[model samples]
Target: MKDRAIERDMDWLVQVFNWAVRFRDDSGRYLLSENPLRGFDIPAELNPRRPIVPRDWMEKVIEAAGPTPLRAMLVIADETGRRLSAIRQLQGSDIQLGRTDAWPHGAIRWRYHSDKVNKDWLVPMSTKLRTEVDRHLAANPVLGDAPLFPAPQNHRKSVSKDRAGAWLLTAIKRAGVQKLDGTLWHAIRRLWITEHKEMPLRERMYVAGYLNRQTMEMVYEHIDPLLLQETVETRREYREAR
Candidate 1:
């Protein structure tokens, strides 16, 4: 397992051990005499940096994903920069196709109940995203409360995150795309965030549903030094004119 994964599991196990220590039976005796794993030192986690998914890699994966629902998920991730947990739980009701004064191209309404931050967000969709969503809806035809991407064996539940990742991995293998550790889904999200670096910080935060500015700036967004230099050079004249 990756260092971060190991660290996370160890932390969770420590919590479990603590809970077991406090657990009492009907006789009011503790279930565990003591937390056996107490004072066990977890290893310091290594840096968990991941590269952004290249546009070519994404194009190849999307093309090779074929008729599967994973294609739609990939497109959404690339376009919206939403987390896999949020994307997988998407329902037909969450999308608003009709144009509004605020959202000319329609919008997506992410609910607080299902969001990782437990906050509601309503953001407008791009024309490309709207078209893709419309096409997916036509093909899958899910209604209110039903998951857009339901499990093949069990329609009652949304497709598991692991299963979705596996599907993406399979597509990656088929497309002959390589490099980086795991979770190409998040890599795609990183690409989306990085691409919007020129946007206002607050607007980008709102669109990406990011509460912590540090994580959004430091983790998700990968700034290109050369690009920044070029941007500054290009805008030098405008700055001088003012």
Candidate 2:
């Protein structure tokens, strides 16, 4: 079979074999002992794809977005460290600009069932990010419990869900942040995860919305050169003082 494989038409072969056994088998229930190749995965490289741009470039993209929906979308990335699902799930009413916590930072509260990860976690709203959201909401206004940015003015639909990709990609191009990594949105998550890795395990977990320490460590941990060097140098200085 291997020797004549290229000439034999692998695609048609599998299709015909499946049809014959599934439909024509006498019992229709008889099964082979195993199908060893059933679980095989396609190589990622064999599939064509682009990648994420760096965070600095992403920031530049948001700047280029100017007063457009593009800027609001990017600012949400900075504020919530939210998944795109979480972002889309927001209603203009959900942003709590009026809430002032005793905590140093401001706050954002949305519903528990709003996104894929069904937990309700409140993210700290840094002053800078808070200002950004207030401004975005002010400019965009509320058409409904729909997308913050609908299609371009000429297009006819108000967004029902998951429109971050289209607008964000346009923003990226406009900003000229063109080098691509495999998952662009993920790079935003990566930015948040990397930024907070050094916080105590419990604290980082709470901020990133992990239910507990172990899951947070397992999923979000990444080594940072500056942090590692700071730890090592601090230890050496302490030892010298002793």
Tell me each candidate's TM-score: 0.79, 0.64
| Candidate maximizing TM-score | 1
lDDT of 1 at 53: 83
Q: Candidate 1 clashing pairs?
A: none
Give lDDT tens digits, candidate 2, residues 35-122.
Answer: 4334544233232332333558867977987887657767777555566666655666566556555645556665677655577776
Give the C-alpha lDDT of model 2: 0.61
lDDT scores of the candidates, listed in order: 0.84, 0.61
Lowest summed lDDT across 10 adjacent residues in model 2 is found at 42-51
Predicted candidate 1 versus true structure: per-residue lDDT over 1-242, tens digit per residue = 76778888988988898888899989998878887877887875566667788779889999899867998898888888888888888887888889988888898887787767999999899888887888888889988888988998998788998899889889989999895566677788898899898899898888878888998887788877789898788853445544
